[model samples]
Target: MQTTFTPAQLENPHTAHSEQIIRKCVHCGFCTATCPTYVTLGNELDSPRGRIYLIKEMLENDRPADAKTVTHIDRCLSCLACMTTCPSGVNYMHLVDHARAHIARTYRRPFMDRMIRQVLAMTLPYPARFRASLTMARLGRPLAPLFAAIKPLKPFAAMLRLAPSHVPAKAAINDPAVHAAEGPRQKRVALLTGCAQSVLDPKINEATVRLLNRLGVEVVVPKGEGCCGALVHHMGQEDEALGFARRNVDAWMRVADEDGLDAILITASGCGTTIKDYGHMLRLDPAYAEKAAKVSALARDVTEFLAELELPLPVNKTDLLVAYHSACSMQHGQKITRAPKVLLAQAGFTVRDVPEGHLCCGSAGTYNILQPEIAATLRDRKVRNIESTAPQAIATGNIGCMTQIGSATQIPILHTVELLDWAFGGEKPASLAGVEPRVEPALAAAE
Candidate 1:
């Protein structure tokens, strides 16, 4: 893991930071076992250890990203399972992120690849554009198989397949407004009504707002707070990503300064991970650096925030078995392993853990759309493990995981908060209809 960056090369902030991360790697290769790409593709270059070497070579030589390096890095899911598996505490997430930014700066992709990446960057982070694109996708969805036959058109095919048939009307909860607590307001926080999640499934936000309000927490959907930049950030669009971070910082800081906020809650774990890292992401900005750090301190996943509350007994307890599919961002990126499951259990569902839980479901932001073949492989594997648990429904904290897994399985996939909200007297999820709850005699007697 010894690096040969010149003192001049080390002078660059990014290179210096990556150097620190690279130095921490002891070349143990423990990451290979857990890396989804390495596990599936069996390519050494596809693993964390392999990519570290490629990154080091590219940086040390101060050359543009070669095809080989770009290919391996592009295949990476950035699941951060390697970070969890590494005994050396290598910050693979930051290192990989730095590598991606470098690739964005130097690598020039093919014509189709460039167009697809550009289209994603332009649309996916904007709600109106994404919604419109979905409308158009329905037309192209019929052509997915035709697109799949051509090599360059595969991403479009993947996108068409993943687009939902029915785009629900935008939820009122996403409007830049406030929902007061149902009772005495104990806390107030801003909710990140994210870009894709808002457009894709506003019900998740609706469920979140309802549950938090019922629990006596005031939720604000702040104006000017748009995407968390995670969608483009992973694509190596550094400037665009940082622009998103700064705008969100301004929006959240305005709320914090004027109305005061107990926390900045995020229902999407992917956004939660990026939002929590605003401190590091904006560390070099003179004006935003301190404010960004403060905001990061206040950022919390909805489950992380809810776990601290004194949850009441479920208003309607049932012996519902839930196979909890921990999103990669939740378990590995943010290291939030227990809160969601603990919350589900307290809400009276029998929470079952999925086997091979540490692996990614291949929904690492835009990874699925960009790398459809490998994404399908990992998704199928994840679905198999999840189905083996024999649960009445699948519960996850991420909209991406819900979509990716739901498309391939019959089990009703729902956000964890939705299930919690339903258990605590809100309306039951429509997807859960006809899903009979098992009766546990001892638990029924206790109830």
Candidate 2:
């Protein structure tokens, strides 16, 4: 893992940082066993160690990204499972992120690839546009089979196939305002009403707000806050992603300066990971550097925040066994392993962990749409692991994982907060209507 960057190359901050990350690799290959691509594709180049070598060669030689390097790098899910598995503590997430940004600068993608990436960049971060596109995608969905036959149109086919048949109505919780605590406000927090999640399943944020309010936490959806920049950030759109970070920083910092926030809560674990990294992501910006660090310090996943609260007994506990599918971002990226499952168990459901829980569900942001074939492979693998648990339903903290797994399985997928909300006396999740919980022995005997 020795690096050979010249003095001039070392002068660039990003190069210097990436070189530091590259030097941490001990070439153990522990990552290969956990990498979804390497596990599925069996290509050395598709593994983190393989991709690290490719990244090192491209950066050290100061050459444009070759087809081989781009292919391997693009296939990466950025699940950060390698970071979790590495004995040497390699920061694969930052290294791969730097590699992606470099690819954006130097690699020229195919026309169709460029078009689809551009369309996703422009559309997904904006809720209104995303909703409209999904509506149009409904018409195009009928043509997915035709598109799948054409190689270049496969991403479109993936997009069409992934779009929900009915777009959810925009929830009122999305309005920029504050929901006061029921009694006294012990803590005030800003909720990240994310771009895709807001449009895809508004109930996540809704459930988060309701549950937090009942627990005496004031939830505010700041007016200027938008996407967490994760969607485009993973695509190597560095400038666009940074733009999103800056806007959110300004919006949330305003609340921090005025009312003082205890936490910036995020229901989507993918966004939570990126939002929590705002410190490192904006460290070079002199003006935003300190503020971004403060913002990142305040960021918390809803489950992480909830695990701290003193809970009353569940008002509507069920005997349902929940197969908790930990999102890659939640478990690997943020290292939040136990909060959601513990919260579910405390809320009176039997929580079971999925086998191979360290692997990604292949829903790393827009990965499913961009790399449909490989995505499908990993997703089916994930669905199989989830189903073996034989739970009444599946629970996860990410909207992306929910969508990806729900597409492949018959089990109802719901956000963890939704189940917690229902248990805490809010309305039951509509997805659970037909799922019958097992009767306890005593109750069955009494009946």
lDDT (0-100) at residue 223 of candidate 1? 86
lDDT of each: 0.93, 0.93
Q: Which tens-of-lDDT digit does each residue in 221-313 have in candidate 2?
A: 999999999999999999999999999999999999888999999999999999999999999999999999999999999999999889889
TM-score of 1: 0.98
Best candidate according to TM-score: 2
List runs of model 2 lying over 4 Å from the truth.
440-447
RMSD (CA, Å), each prediction: 1.9, 1.2
The C-alpha stretches of model 1 lying farther than 4 A from their native spots are 439-447
Q: Give the per-residue lDDT of model 1 (tens digit) for 1-447.
A: 788889999899999999999999999899999999999999999999999999998988999998999999999998999999999999999999999999999989999999999999999999999999999999888899999999999999999999999998977888899899999999999999999999988989999999899989999889899999998999999899999999999999998988799999999999999999999999999999999999999999999999989988899755699999999999998999999999899888999999999989888889899999999999999999999998999999998998899889999999999999998878889999888888678979999
Q: Itemize residue pairs with steric clashes in candidate 1.
A: none
